[model samples]
Target chain A: MIVVEALSKQFGRFQAVDEISFEVQRGEVLGFLGPNGAGKSTTMKMLTCYLPPTSGNAEVNGFSINSQPLQVQEQIGYLPESAPSYNEMQVEEFLTFIGEVRGFSGTELRRKVGRVLELTSLQDARKQIIDTLSKGFRQRTCLAQSLIHDPPVLILDEPTDGLDPNQKHEVRELIRRMSEERTILISTHILEEVEAVCSRALIISEGRLVGLGTPDELLSQSIYRNAVTLSVSGKSAEALLEDLNGLEQVYSVERLEDMPSGALTVRVFPKDRESISSELEQFLKKKKMVIEQFFVERGRLDEVFRNLTLGN
Target chain B: MKGLFPIFKRELLAYFRSPVAYVFIIIFLAANAGCTFMLGNFYDSNQASLEVSFLFHPWLYLFLIPAVGMRLWAEERRSGTGELLLTLPVRTSVSVFGKFLAGWAFIAVALILTFPMIITVHYLGFPDNGPIITGYLGSFLMAGAYLAITSFTSALTKNQVISFILSVNICLILVLLGWGVLSEILNTIFPVWLTDVISQFSFTTHFDAIRRGVVDLRDIVYFLSIIIFMLMTNVVVLESKKAS
Candidate 1:
């Protein structure tokens, strides 16, 4: 539903978004991962047509953001960073105003506003003035207005930035429910948010796309892939490590500290792209060595993200 | 036009949503009455017409209009609703004109509330209603012009105080161009025709024409042109901010 091509935004000597290109199809929720000053907000602003890109542009739902910005804006429901809203307005009134601007009125405007309020769980606070609402409520009110038009694409900047853990989970579930038909691009510094809600993620740093893939794909690229940790009894870790080193797929083996229960812990590193589980099991059976714990670990995404964005 | 309706409604409703509109109205009514009776000496002049009240409008609007217009754009920027308003599927003209109209309507409300003085004048004697009606018209037009200038200054910065001060300075200069002493000082160095043309741009000159019971087309057009010119500048300012 959205395509950005070689889009760059430079402010005098500083480049905020540098020649970054990406596409998001309907039903895809793309997580934008970056730290502070990483151009996440700037990229979303360019996409929303809030700021014109210094060069190049993006298209939303078949409309150029530069040439047909009004049309592009009609199709986008942007939740700017900090979720700015008119503080003097009541929540219900604000949503109605947005609905009216989106070309809905009378029964239609009422119905759309009602629907968004329900979706964002803002019905109870609808009567309260925006400035009087709590931060979580205010954020949800922002979310409500973005949905007031039922746009095909949503660009949310830190939707759950200051929410409590429960509120964050609720918003995540809401995004998940809405992810079936809408294309969503949400930027967040919270790594686990990508793991929880995004089908694919793009990690940007220093105004460049550093990593782009499914969470699992990026995780598998970590150095920890195919590494195994084992706890065994009836054998010293030295003996186990020595035997595991003799296996063909075993790249290396190291002994860990002894467990509190006296079981020796050892870690086995398999050769690249190799899985030695079955062979190691058979070898253990042949030796009659009892195993306490055996775990073949998946790579940690946090470790992968840190290496991708900050390593370079 | 349809797209601008909601923005206009929201902006107009914003004034009433807070105490700013009420406080402004009360203070405005008192100030207008004070300027007419205390400074213009309306009763002492024994003027059955609203000439004294109308005469002080330009001076009163100099400060009052800017106070109302300063927050029109600066508050939006400070509160971050600039993003919300600008991202709507409306053209820059729609937003700019909508907000300008809302503020102009507010100044209209303040002007309309001076009806008690009008009633007083009519009850005191058979006043020439023609002059009074055109006087209010000129005052309203001059207000629209001053408000347009204030709106432009407001768009230049996010600070309300700076917006107010800048607008007051600009409005003061525009007002002073037609002042007697200023013209006298300028006529010493410049040609008489040049001085006349320079003073013609002042709001006071056109306002004076209308206040004298003559609603000339050029005077009306002059006030409207100033409003249009400033709002066009407002559009450029808003657009250029987005470009960077």
Candidate 2:
């Protein structure tokens, strides 16, 4: 449903979005993960035809953004980073006006507005002024406006930025439901959100695509292989570190200290753990090291994100 | 045209939903009425005509029209709604012209409210209603032209004050071009034909022709050309933003 080729945008001497390309298929939820000022919003703006790209081209629903912007705009609904709205307009009035501008009329416009308000859970706030609503409600209202036209493509920038935890969950659920029908490109910094909702993730840094893969694929690329943390007490920290480092299957080991009497926390990176766990058990028994706690430390999505982004 | 009507209706509703249209109408009517009755000496002049009342409109619209036009685009920029508006399916010219027409229509409402003055003139004596009608037609067209220019200026910046000041400055230049002082300066430096060409561009010349009850086709075309020209510039300014 969407294609971007070598899309670059420059403002004076600064390049906001470098040459980046990606495609989103129909009924796919693609998460755009990046830190602040990483060209996420700029990319969304170019795709929405709000700002023309300085180089290359972007097409939505088979229409070039630069050549046939009005047609492209007609097919895509965009919620900018700020989720801007007119404060003086009531919820229903604002949505109706947007629907009318997008070519909905009479019973169709009314029905669409009603459907979107219910979809965004903004039905009760329909009569309230936008300025009087809470941040969460305002965000929902912004979402309602974008959905009123029933566009096939949705470009949502930080759709859950200001919502509470429960509201965030509701929005995430709503997005998951909506993804079944529309092509969604959602930009956010929340790593867990991608794991929970997105089928694919695209990580961008410094206006460049750093990583793109599924959640498990990204987690497997971490430096630490599958290993367990063994808290031993009888052996000194120095001795445990020395013995773990000398093991043939051990890649690396680090001792974490809490206090003189506390259990030793050791993170072991194993090269070949199939035979190493039995060997380590026998060695610890012979050395008479008291093992208090042992648990396998799985790589987390947050750790993967931190490592990937920080390493670059 | 079907696409244009929705934008026009939305813009008109927006104006009324806030205090913008009301405040503009109230201040416009008050100032226009006060100037006609007190400053122009409507009853005291007793010339058996609305000439004095109609004469004051050019000066009134000079500043009042900017108030209506300054927010045409600047508020959208300030509120971060420009992206939302620009990304809609409607063509740029359609939206720009629709918005300009809405502002002009609101100003026309305020102008029409001055009918009491017309009634007062009709009650006192026999006034030439032909010139009065054409004068209003000329004033409405001039206001549309000025509002279009102001709307174009508003799109250039996010600051409404700057938009107002720039529009007033540009309108001042156009209003003053055909005056004796400007003509005297131009007559000394340029040939008589060049001076005449320059004077013809001034709104004052065409407006004067309509105020004399002539309704020349050339004057109508001149006013319309200015309106269309300024609206086209407004579209260009907005489109340039998308490019850079």
Chain A alone, TM-score per model: 0.93, 0.86
List the pairs of residues colliding in candidate 2: none
What digit string (tens of lDDT, one per residue) describes model 1 on residues A181-232? 9999999988889889999999998899999999888878776777788887
The digit string of per-residue lDDT tens for model 1 on B72-105 reads: 8898888888888788788888888989999999
How far off is residue B232 in model 2, in Å? 0.7
RMSD of each: 2.0, 2.8
Off by over 4 Å in 1: A237-268, A273-293
Clashing pairs in 1: none
Which has the greatest TM-score? 1
Quality of model 2 by C-alpha lDDT: 0.85
Binned by DockQ into CAPRI classes (incorrect, acceptable, medium, high), candidate 2 is medium
After superposing candidate 2, which stretches have Cα over 4 Å from the reference? A224-243, A257-261, A272-312
Error at A310, model 1, angstroms: 1.9
